[model samples]
Each structure stands twice: as C-alpha cells, then as structure tokens.
Target: MSGDSTESDVAQETTDDDGPKTHSTSFKIARALFGGVLAFTALDNFRKLDEMIAFADSEGAPAAERSVPAISGSLLFGGLGIAAWKLPRLAAGAVATFFVAITPVMHDFWSRDDDEEKEQHAIHFLKNAALLGGALAFLRVAQDD
Candidate 1:
C-alpha cells in the first residue's frame, strides 16, 4: 500500500471527510506578514490622504493625478491581500507579478542623483511592493470565503 500511495495520490484523495490541514507555523508567519502589511497599509492610507494629495498638487501633476487613486488601489489590494490567506498560491503569484511590473517605475533609485532622494524613492517603492503582496493575500482569502 505504501508503495502505491505516493504523496501526490494521497493529496489528490483528500476530501470533505478529511478537511485540509491547518496552516503551518511558517505559513502563518508568511500570511501574517502579507495580511498585516496590507491591512496596516489600508489603515496608513487614511493618514496620508491629504498629504499625498498635497504632494501631487505640489508636483504639478494633473488634477486627475492624486493620491486617492493609489489609495483606492491599495485598499482594494489591501482587502484582497488579507483575504489571500485561503488561496495563497495564486495570490502570491499575482502579487509577485504586480510588484515586478511596477517596482522599477516606483523605486527608480538608479536615476535619482541625491542619496537622500534615492532613499526616499526606495521607501515609497517598498511600500507599494508590500501592499501588492498584502493585496494578493487579501484577495486569496476573499476568494476562499
């Protein structure tokens, strides 16, 4: 029987009679890292709304260009990131893809001349990345629910 029952076969056989195993300790850590980041970011967005708007205005961005857009986007992902708990694989992949696409644009340290300026740029870039990961997690849990 042991020779015939490969891990894949056993996994394929899992059913309602034997519910899914609980999250492992390491998985719990990863989940917390992802979900907590998004949830915290969603909370953080509120504090920065006016400042972000002001920064956009100061930067001479168009009227349509505002922190609100990023905030809303982050919130959507943030909620999704938290939800991603139940659907970790897809959620993780999506977040990684999203971050990869957006990171260079958001965190362009190579172009910025000043060290302080680069530092600031990096911070913003990391924030967006973390949120992306978080949102992935949130969406996963959401999908599961």
Candidate 2:
C-alpha cells in the first residue's frame, strides 16, 4: 500500500501543467534558426564553389578548393542534426571546429597591410569567435541534459 501511494505521488509530480508550452516552442524555433544559418551558408558555398575557391586562393588558401566540399557537407548535415535536436553535441562540436579552423586561415587580420582590409578581417574573425562560443554553450547545455 505504501509503494502504491509513492508511485501515485511520483506520477502526479510528473504530470503536465495547464500553462502554455511556449518555452519549448521557442526553443525549437531557435534551434531551427541556428541550424538554418549553417545549412544556408553551406548551400551558398556549394552554389558558389568556384568563386569561394577563387577567394580562398586569393587569401593564400589554394587547398580550399579541395576542402570546400567536405566542409560544406559537414555544415549541412551538422546543422540539420542540431536543428532536429539529434546528436546536438556532436553537431555543435563540428560547427565549432569549422569556425575555429577557418577563422585564422580566412580572417588573418594580422597579415593584412591595408587598414580597411584589416578591420574587415578582424570583424569576421571576431564574429566567428562569437559563433564558436555559442556552439560551446550549446554543447554545455546538451551535456547538462
């Protein structure tokens, strides 16, 4: 009889409340938006591979031509995984790695002599860094879950 009572209490505690479930809906939308950015960027990269490769070559990353496909594919699938809340940690880690690896290579502000170029590169570098931080935060949240 005591065990039955305890089970009933547990079930009651787990029951859903009558309040709006907006928090969950908002989280889902946020996740999809986050992943959408990555996926869209990946698609853009694929669509303009030649132009991207040319830009990379101009930036002294000639090998980017060979690597763009793999990078774009990672972003596409990783973003999808994140949006779907499936293997989010892994997806976030991959996105984070992409940002970290590309930041220095693509946004080498220190290597630029022109002030305008330097400032532009610096902005891009910092933006990527901030994105990396967001990805790390996502990973931490996923781990907490």
Candidate 3:
C-alpha cells in the first residue's frame, strides 16, 4: 500500500464509535478543574455545616437543616464523577440541579431592598446561572459521549 493510504488507514482505525478522534488533554484538564472546584466547595460546605445551615435558614430556605447535607453530598459526588468521567451526564445533571435550586433561593436580589445587597445578590445569581448553563451543556456533551 502507498504511504498516504497507510496513513489514512491508521487514522480510520483510531476513530471512536462516536466520531473522529482527537487528543483530549485540554478537555480532561477542564473536566478535572470543574470537578475540583465543586468538590472543594462541597468540602468547605461540610466543614461549615452549622454556618451553612444558619445562612440557609436566614435566607428563608425551607428545610435548610436537611437540604444542606443533601446538597453538599451531591456536590462532592457529582464533582468526583465529573472529574473521573464516570457517569458524567448524571454528575452534570446533579450539579445543574444544585445550581437551579440554590440560585433563586439564596440569591434573590429582587427581594433585597438595599442597593448594595441587591447588586451583590444579582452578581451571585448571574454567576450561578452561567454555571448552570455550562453544566447543562456539559451534560449534553457527556450524553453524546
């Protein structure tokens, strides 16, 4: 066989069922960083459970006592799963749910009367919204994978 034909054959052989193959170093790094951030935040939440609960309570979240642990555990496991690329769709979904659930509850800037507090909450709310969008997109990509 000619060199060009042999090279084409090698490329075809490397293609995955999903599609054409490519190095995934950057993707892997991004996934790990995303997971690491979530995991670290979860650890912090656990370390400050009482404070988290108090903050949740102050924010008027229903069942703050029960929700704190549940959310923290979800964040820890979901983050790890994403990092490991294990059931990443589920992990991304969990993270997305967490963002959706907490956004309005914790950062309801509309409810704040003070301008500074309103702006602060609005910033957090928008940030979480962006994260949620990213998580959802990741979920789609994971599903495709």
lDDT of 2 by residue, 35-137 (tens): 8888898889999999988887788864787876777788887688778878888998888888877789899999999999999999999998987887787
* lDDT-superior candidate, 2 or 3: 3
lDDT of 1 by residue, 34-140 (tens): 65665565566566767655655654444625434554465446445534464555545555555665466546766789999999988988887766656555444
lDDT of 3: 0.85
How close to the true structure is residue 76 of candidate 3, measured as C-alpha lDDT?
Answer: 86
Model 2 lowest lDDT segment of ten = 14-23
- Give the TM-score of each candidate: 0.50, 0.79, 0.84
TM-score of model number 2 = 0.79
Model 1, residue 79: distance off in Å is 5.2
Q: At residue 124, give the lDDT of candidate 2.
A: 96
Error of 3 at 38 (Å): 0.9
Model 2 ranges off by over 4 Å: 1-23
